[model samples]
Target chain A: DAGVTQSPTHLIKTRGQHVTLRCSPISGHKSVSWYQQVLGQGPQFIFQYYEKEERGRGNFPDRFSARQFPNYSSELNVNALLLGDSALYLCASSSLFRDRVTGNEQFFGPGTRLTVL
Target chain B: ELKVEQNPLFLSMQEGKNYTIYCNYSTTSDRLYWYRQDPGKSLESLFVLLSNGAVKQEGRLMASLDTKARLSTLHITAAVHDLSATYFCAVDTPLVFGKGTRLSVIA
Candidate 1:
């Protein structure tokens, strides 16, 4: 079974430009989450979509948005990108069960490296 | 707001040595995860610890969680050069991560 996959291994954009990163979840996974990992820092959660609905969001600003498709693939878009937005964008997929007691193991992708010049 | 902290942001040890990484979170959460990442690579799941006193081990790495103290520990036993990487502990309140611990196992 293939793991979560992300596209455009590397991207270069300018300040005030817009960029979109895509992710395809593993088979049978229903939830997709986006994260931004700055160099030398841990990943920060941006958005989480479960069953095509926004389930959670992190401290990111409105410039960051994400949506999940019926097939559990997702796209993360950043508008008016700033120099601070340069980082590796990661995507993770998991099966969110109804019961909270179960531990959902998130599978991550080889994040897309975004650079704002 | 929840916050996660990892102690010893960096670790350097010779092969066959042992070390442990600590993770402390501000809020209560039962689900904790350990992930390893090589330079310029994505994260690889190491352990998923759920509930108080949950412990899991794989090869030379072991992870334990204490929900009461909101702490988790990743212990590396007899470390090898191949184990050199950054390790991160995350609390699954939808997943919040701590500053990773970069481990360099010298051979």
Candidate 2:
């Protein structure tokens, strides 16, 4: 089976511009999560959607928003991008998502590399 | 908010040597995860430890978790150069990550 897939392997945007990155979850998976990773750092969670509902969010700014589709695909949008926003955006998928007691193995996509010039 | 910390942010060892990386989290959580990320690459799931004293092993790497101490460890046995990469441990407060430990296996 195909794993989680992300689109637009690379993107270049100017400051104050907007960008959207897309992800398709694995078959039978219903939860999608977004993460931003800067160089030499671990990924920082942005948003998580389960069954097309917002389930969790991280400390990112309001400029970052995301939504999930019925098919478990997701889009992460960043508005008024800044040079500080330049990083790799990742998408993860899992069949289940309960933080402490329950959760299926999560898988990650290749990620979208975005550069704000 | 929960925080995750990793010790020895960098590791360098000779092939056939063994080393362990440690992860400590601030909150109580039973779910801990280990992931490997190569340069310019996405993360690859390595281990999922769901309970106290949970241990899992694959290939030359082993991961163990202790919920009581809120600690997890990833041990690399007989390291190989191919195993060079950054390793991160995440706690399941909806998934919070550590700064990651970069490992380099030298000849």
Candidate 3:
């Protein structure tokens, strides 16, 4: 089976511009999450969607937003980008929102490398 | 606030050596996860520990979790160059992540 896939493996944009990164979850998966990984750091969660509904959100600014389509694919949009936003944006998907007792494993895509100039 | 921390932000060892990477989290959490990422690469899931005293292993890597102590460890046995990468540990609540440990194995 194919793993979760992300589109536009690389992107470059200028400050104040808007960028859209896309992700397709693994077959049979329904939940999608987005994360940002800056240089020399771990990935920080940004948003999560399950059944096309927002389930969780991280401490990102309003300029960052995301939505999941009915087909379980997701799009992460960032507006008015800054140089600090240049990093690898990762997308992960699982069967559902995990519970403490029954945890779910998040499968990540290769990620989109976005460079804000 | 939930925070995950990993010890020895960087590790350098020769092939055939053994080492352990520690992960400590603040507060109580239900699950702990270990992931590996290469330079400019995405994360690859390694292990998930769901409960106290949970232990899991794959090939030359082993991971153990202690909910009471709020700690987890990833031990590499007979490390090889293929194991070189950054390792991160995450907690379940909001999936808090550590800064990551960069491991370099030299032959």
Scored against the true structure, residue B31 in model 2 reaches a CA lDDT of 85
Candidate 1 per-residue lDDT over residues B1-107, each given as its tens digit = 88999999999999999999999999988799999999999999999888899999999999999999999999999999999999999996578999999999987
Our tally of clashes for model 1 stands at 0
Better of 2 and 3 by DockQ: 3
List candidate 3 stretches off by more than 4 Å.
A99-102
TM-scores for candidates 1 onward, in order: 0.97, 0.97, 0.97
**What lDDT tens digits, residue by residue, belong to model 1 across residues A1-117?**
899999999999999999999999999989998999999999999999999999989989999999999898999999999999999999999888333655888889999999999
Per-residue lDDT over A6-108 for candidate 2, one digit per residue giving the tens place of the 0 to 100 score: 9999999999999999999999988999999999899999999999999999999999999999888999999999999999999999887664444456789
Ranking of models by DockQ: 1, 3, 2
Write out the backbone clash pairs for model 3. Answer: none
TM-score of 3: 0.97
What is the C-alpha local distance difference test score of each model?
0.93, 0.92, 0.93
Q: Which wins on DockQ, candidate 1 or candidate 3?
A: 1
Estimate the TM-score for candidate 2.
0.97
